[model samples]
Target: METLANLESFVRSAEQGGFSGAARRLGLTPAAISRNVAMLERNLGIRLFHRSTRKLTLTEDGERFLTAIRDNLEGLQAAIAEAGGERREPAGVLKVSLSPTFGTDHILPLLPDFLKSYPGIQIDWQFDNRQVDLVAEGFDAAIGGGFELSPGIVSRVLAPAHIIAVASPAYVAGRTLPLDPAGLGELDGIVMRSDRTGRIRQWMMRNAAGEEMAAAPKETIVVNDPAAMCRAALLGLGVTLIAVPDVLPHLESGALIRLVPKWYADAGPISVYYASRTLLPAKTRVFIDFVADHFKRQRLAERFAGSLG
Candidate 1:
């Protein structure tokens, strides 16, 4: 195989019309450029140039080799330029993995703006409820709810995810509302199957005395998707423990009512994680900034629910 360095030197010499000219352009001595070209010619078993003191001429073999490799050489240059140009602007493909519910609520709605702003970029998205291997999957970033993030990845706290228990007003009709966390066992509920915890999720609550506790209602329905569970609660199927943003609209519309007041569980921060911070790609950086600004301006959990109301 032809060495890239030698091929580069040979191409430069041919384009510049002489070894000294190629050397000057490449920041190498003329002797070094000549050596590179000679090495390339010997490796390829072809005499690339017919040379004299006055002028240089390409041999037939040289012309054919140049024609074949010119495009490849130019492609290499363009790639190098793009990689180095990241400091100035965003470019290239960006892969992001996220929970389907969070992506639908927060990122998907604002995606058009991101695409419009950076027309040169492309994206690959993976939306799943299961934890994914971000690095192995080549994901530039991941957006997830809850506090614990996989080690070895960089993460940022983008927003607080509020966990609350809510049910349709019809479900509460003719029934005394659960006055205490212990009373929750008498009510029916839709629960999320937590992949991380490997069990059916229990509603988290705080009592009037400020004690945090988990309540698993005796009458419960298990489901995976938060949006689906919220919808079920709206239809008076059962109480659903969901993110505040997911149920905001129902609360306003008087369709769903918050079961616990301010004592609802605080699930901690919603985080946006990426592979590394040392050198973030342009597309990933732009999306991160956009997400941070979006949650700050709209308060994700509130705006969507407010819309329903």
Candidate 2:
């Protein structure tokens, strides 16, 4: 019986059309690949390829053998993948990056429960305001908002985020509230830089009559940090455009009021992304599954609350 390791090298070399290419793909030296294939041939008592200085061609027997080997090999690979997907005892380090505000508002608050469930998985969490290259940083996952996602990465939308225009109670005390999105031009705006480019954020709003438009002040005070912008708005600096969850506390406390209640919009989706590589490490798969289930339960609760209202 031939060892699977030797058979794998032979199949790789045949599929890659050359030993060097297969070696590169398998992260092995060309000499090592040749040795493995030679060993496979010796064990099987057959030549799998017609070799030359400039070319390597599969023999008739090699072609037929390779076809059968290919199927078996693929089956073996799928079996391994399925086995690895079982994250019941995920035990390893899981590194993740997330937006600072979202991390503080959502992820941090729910982390204790996650730790309780999977005590085997250790987390190295980093809060970042800027976009991070997960592959380069060696992060297992990332949580972010936006419709656009990086290529070669798998993404699952956690929730539909709501963006609202809000201002402090003090700012609205003597001011005329905007009944429509068009009236936003008459108010002082505090623009927060929530995106990577540091541009002043604009409000996408719709009036009670359902007329929609994007609004921003001619003169705007731009702030980089969402927390700082929230603080400024709460202190009555100006009306700010922010995600609802970030300002939910202030809304409940009567510290801030919606400037244009009818103008709230769904700010696309908040997603958790990870590399789409075929083989996922145990810890990463565990966290992804848990996070998805957690958000599903949260959405269900939200639906119940909305029904009660």
Against the true structure, what is each candidate's TM-score? 0.66, 0.70
lDDT of 1 at 59: 96
Counting only residues 3 or more apart in sequence or on different chains, how many pairs clash (N, Cα, C under 3 Å) in candidate 1? 3
Worst lDDT run of 10 residues, candidate 1, spans 300-309
Screening candidate 1 with a backbone cut-off below 3 angstroms (N, C-alpha, C), the clashing residue pairs are: 245-301, 248-305, 249-305
Angstrom error of the Cα, residue 7, model 2: value is: 11
Residue 258 alpha-carbon offset, candidate 2, angstroms: 1.1
Error of 2 at 8 (Å): 11
Candidate 1 residue lDDT tens string, 186-259: 88878888766768876667654668777666546787788789888888887776777666667778888877
lDDT of 2 by residue, 1-309 (tens): 777678878887886688886775455688999999999888888999999999899999899999887778767766776876664577777888988887787778878888898899887999987667665456788987763566647788776567777788888888888776567778877777646655666667655555678767434567787788798888888877777767767877898887667666656767888876565666787788888887787762253121121
Q: How accurate is candidate 1 locally (lDDT)?
A: 0.74
